[model samples]
Target: MALATSRFLPVLDCPDPRGLAAFYRDLLGWQVTQDSDDWVELSRDGYLALAFQLAPQFVPRAWPAEGVHSHIDVFVDDLDDAEREALRLGALRVDHPPTPQKFRVYRDPAGHHFCLCTT
Candidate 1:
């Protein structure tokens, strides 16, 4: 018999699981698949799922810091349109406007760095 392989799911830990889950829910238009005091799962069409977990000791990542995860990249079809929409949706613009390469970076309400790149 063949060994079963499972797909990987990206899990994010933060102080406020509900807040983080809402951010992603709005940003990605995903619906809440599961919710609890300590965790929440967001999914769309059963293909993409993102999990947010509550971590009492959660320490936000310092992207440019010496030993922290840099950032998460999200590819979009229209960089300008997406940036404008993201700003309207409460994302703080961390970097300057989109460059010629068609990418812009921003920070979520909880300080996680993410980028919008033209795909």
Candidate 2:
């Protein structure tokens, strides 16, 4: 048996919904499909991909620390170029020791961890 779904949206909680959404929007070149004070949604092509919800007392988890549940991994044609663009879009590099060979970790402006990876 399997569950059927129409759409799937992975939402991230941040202090500022629009701000966080903007960061991802710029990073991924996605369009803002919906926006409000406490929530924002982004779409790629024509499908909803990601969303951000306002968390008033949000405390971002530190890299290499406990409480990190999951993170986003983005595939790119060129890792160097993607890294440069991500940095320019307000992403901070998180150079943990013994970094992976296929990907590099980074923290978004809202402090959520993500990876820029190459195929």
| TM-scores for the candidates | 0.82, 0.91
Candidate 1 structure quality by residue, lDDT tens digits, 14-99: 88889988988988899999999998999989878888888878666655554457566878888778888878777887676537
lDDT over C-alpha atoms for residue 31 of model 2: 96
What residue pairs clash in candidate 1, if any at all? Answer: none
Instruction: Please give the lDDT score for candidate 1.
Output: 0.80
Q: What are the lDDT figures for the candidates, one per model?
A: 0.80, 0.89
Candidate 1: stretches off by over 4 Å: 1-3, 67-70, 97-101
Predictions: Cα RMSD each: 2.8, 1.6
Candidate no. 1 TM-score? 0.82
Which 10 successive residues of model 2 have the least lDDT summed? 94-103
lDDT, residue 62, candidate 2: 69
